[model samples]
Target: MTDTERLRRWRLVLGGDDDGTGATLTGDDARMDAALYKLYGSRPGGRGGRRGAGLGDSAPSVARWLGDVRTYFPTPVVRVMQRDAIERLDLTRLLLEPEMLDAVEPDVHLVGTLLSLHRLLPDRARESARAVVARVVADLERRLAQRTRSALGGALDRTARTPRPRRPAEIDWGATIRANLRHYLPEHNTVIPERLVAYGRRQQAIKRDVILAVDQSGSMAASLVYASVFGAVLASLRSLRTSLVVFDTSVVDLTPDLHDPVELLFGARLGGGTDINRAVAYCASLVDRPDDTILVLVSDLYEGGVRDELLQRIARLTASGVTVIALLALSDEGTPAYDTENAAALAALGVPAFACTPDRFPDLMAAAIEHRDLTPFTNHNT
Candidate 1:
């Protein structure tokens, strides 16, 4: 009937724990409440602080109040809750956010929290995380912008490594030069043969490219948040080509809309049937050179379309030399709900499927770049 009542229903629908006595909620009411709670909670209480007494014997009312606010919580309120949860829960400490970040650099949401935590972190630890964040951001942007070179422009490409590009710039100069060396030689009578001479005057164009193909099904919202930030980073790369695709039964190319991560996320329809086959084929069409591209498929591997076709398409891409890595997720959570049968099928095709937090993306990219063998399933390692 009301926004509060609607949110309660949707929460239960989302597999949230609810007492199960509520009025029915239409889609409009649920959306409105979600917006409202995102803006402001129904009841007033900062995270971790105790509510005043007489609320309830078991805090049911308190939870109810929070749920009522959940749908219509304000953006500022939601942000505070996010901040508070990070603080009070001490999730960073428990999850080893700092160390995990060092091992695998995550996106802005994680970086922002760590930045907040940086105040309390030891100097060395904080510095290390910052450095990792800096590198990770740069690397991630490159991955996001797979082929749209010059997005950030000449300043990044022409710049040398001494001072380094900040936030989102990591160009592989040696690789680029070596890749284009044949063109540099004079046609008439030039025999440039020694590794020493080639190394002596090597100035390569360092460019970054990233392609983010995400599944927009219901179970992927948290991972979607990280994906949006990563999209923003990829959009920042001047030398790399970047594109974002969010799919349900249908696929939509959101590459032209990477300016705002929030908008990019809203562009996605979070819950729907999956067509991994169609999504992959669509992404394959976008790839100019599979060898130069890194295709990250963030999905549970469920196929609503033809399953055999999906596996065959993936095998084709891998054979074409595309760096196809399967990520079950990019959330703080270990592994969200996924499709085991689909994962197994793709694994058989040699597609590397793993459940990874955003923190591990940087190392994962590095490994992908080095052409190292990637493990196909996330659960196997654990």
Candidate 2:
């Protein structure tokens, strides 16, 4: 590797500590080092090391450090550092403070932490926490709304096209001509269209039902945020009926709050035993049109309820023409922890189970809505 690349690698490995790596950072790199040191450097009695004294017991110091990290690092790196501060420095309690919430960068993980501490947040801090969550939800909506709407809308248009038509008004001439070019007869010096493709009549609109059955067992926090945001987006469309169901031993339908993802997330009760079977049963009940509904179960598949019943429910959904899919996670974080056996069983039932990143989720939904084979995503888990 080049000298610069080597220095970068060593800087990451040593974190903020001044090791004997003979590499000195400058400019923004130096500023990043200082921010890292503030969070990860040693203090008083301890020797100089990567494990630092943390932000100490002072809320102001912690708040300053939060601002510094956001200023120095990119959003993604800042989010990771924020999570690390919460885990390593025991800053979860401080998050209940208004100043701390005000200073921190809004993200899914931070929202998850706030949701976990919901019952404990004082009245004064509750408003601030909700603001933070609202900001994050708005940012996510801006980033994902258009892409999701376009993909699902396109899928609906494609699915509405019929291959056979009895009337000329229903015929999709462009598609029909494209699909029948192979039947051209050179002897007759003309193109003979053997098959007719048409667009479905635009009458009593066929609204698709989308049920987001998400697992909210503490570990699935990121997935919950993504699912809520997507649910809100789907619910906005007049052509789709969207329902949000979050489960952790119990199921809570947040469909009414789908207009605001922040509210939907706040309604969720995180951290509890998972009951996949019960959740699936509830989602199944919501499906009025089995052929048009897409049931996405976002879970790690660590079944705390009846495992056999869970598999049976999934099998029944798939057999009944409901596009049943299992998402182990819905974050950018690399491969997630999920039950291999459960994933395998879902696969056996013709249901694709895999971890899907938020960016890929829109396309995944498009594929599901269009009834396309999900081998591209499912094969990754296998």
Candidate 3:
């Protein structure tokens, strides 16, 4: 394909807008360039030239297009499409082959590529094809961790200087009065202590516990991705303790791999019959203080387990002081066809069944940390 043909195809893909003079792609050209930059910026030669097919006359550009094809095309044709695109560019940069490797490693390399393809993905593909996001985040986590300690060390220092509140103490006033007797002036007046203040602030150590119970049934892929990311974040916090449990028929504690989110996600069984009740019971047992622990159940509420037992377990967890959050999902799409009847039943038990969005999760964690009531998201019963 000539550069002009490539430019024409790209224009068609981006929904070309007609400029009166027709000298340039304009409007949509700018938009497509921005999108292309986002997909290719990590590579060299990603910057410059918002117009012209020659803008993409580079090895990295062809590599990125190959990456895009691998992400957008079905499993069968991805490799063929990538090879053809690489041949068309005929560039010898390392990115060409790396891009092919990036495409073929379905579970590892497709995440960032898919994230770039988000705008183009259809509904069915959006849910089904996003399983690779966990792998991407795992890769990202490794890269971030390398420089994180040095970058965050100063921030940690600022936090360490903050004053903490003191707790009420049981005390004897006699010793307090004796210590203050010198100020009382023994010659003229005797002073009684109005109230006793502790010599120093005694701050109680607060330990936060987060229990993430993820439902790993086939369609709940997005929820699994979000759960893995959040579990890793909670694990990194100094004050919080996080346990990540993924389940379908049985619960497996992936907490030990929290430091490596990808490992935790890979350790999970992604598709199977869901026994939500069994998972909840297992999660309840793993937590020490029900009140101090935040139990986040991410599922569609589809169950192979007994419904009555599941509701009872949720109730028990809440009544025991565990801040139970029954999330039908943790995705950009709030909730999809969930079990409404089961959701309502759990809500009645004070379980707060609601759909949680990924962006609102940090606030949810804050509420959990403070042991405060979480303002539930849209309630889609069922």
Candidate 4:
């Protein structure tokens, strides 16, 4: 690599520390250094000596620092730095302030923090928090909405196919040809289909019920954001009944807010003890047809509720033909901190438990809707 590239990498690694590395930053690099220093540099003490620095006590100073990071770095890098500030400087409580809320860039992690702090936020700051959550929700919707809709819609269409056709319009030519490809005659060089496959007529009634039972513990903030967005997308389909239920110790049904993910997210209460069995029982009550329901539980499986009851409930759901899935997390942060015992117990009951990224979720849902083996998707991601 070039010397400039090496310097940039070392600058990022060293952060705001000046350890006599014999490297000098100029131009844009110098500006980057200034931004980093604002967040991580040491400050001069009142007695004219050096003191440990931080985000400072002033809200506006932190706000301006937020803006400087955004201006100096790309969106992804800004998100990482913002997350680091929250951790290193203990800035999560400050996020409840309206001015602080306005200054920071919106992302899944930020939304997670806001949701966790929702109950403690003052009335005046609640609106600002909602706005920040809304911005992140809108961005995720723009990026994932179309892909999710297309994947699930295709799955629904595929599942609607039948072997018997009443008219030519209903025939699935591609499926028919593939099903009979082994019957090709060498002389004629053409395949003859002994049976026909046809698309079922569009149903005016609901065909499937999707229940997203999300764990809202403080660690599950990212999963909550992704689940809310997906709930909204699934609810938009005419042939599916979608419901979103968020739980910590208590369960709150946010299905009513599925049309607006922002509102759904705001309705959630993050950070509390988890009760997987209680939440699963509540989700079970929503299932009118166990054979046609998809229950996706997004949690780390750190069950604070009854353990035996949770395992039994999952066993019952699977026995009743309910397609139950346990997602350890739903972000790109890779394998999350999860309870391996609970995960393995669920696996023993014939339910696949794994961590899925946001990009793979649509495909996972489609696979579940079609009752296909989830090992391919799960194994690949895990």
Report the candidate with higher lDDT, 1 versus 3: 3
TM-score of each: 0.51, 0.87, 0.56, 0.91
lDDT of 1 by residue, 5-37 (tens): 676665534422242445454576655544334
Summarize candidate 3's per-residue lDDT along 181-225 as a digit string, tens digits.
756856768855544534221222436578999998867776786
Q: Report the C-alpha displacement of residue 152, candidate 1, in angstroms.
A: 15
Q: Ranking under lDDT, best-scoring first?
A: 4, 2, 3, 1
Candidate 4, which segments miss by more than 4 Å at Cα? 1-12, 15-20, 42-50, 182-193
Please report, in order, the local distance difference test score of every candidate based on alpha carbons. Answer: 0.59, 0.85, 0.61, 0.87
Error of 2 at 279 (Å): 1.1
Judging by lDDT against the true structure, name the best candidate: 4
Candidate 4 residue 128 C-alpha distance from true site, Å: 2.3
Q: Give residue 284's lDDT in candidate 3 (0 to 100).
A: 76
Best by TM-score: 4
Clashes by residue pair, model 2: 41-52
Candidate 4 TM-score over all chains jointly: 0.91
The CA root-mean-square deviation of candidate 1, after full C-alpha superposition on the true structure, stands at 17.6
TM-score of 2: 0.87
Cα lDDT of model 4 by residue, 103-145, tens digit: 9989999888888888899998999988888888899999998
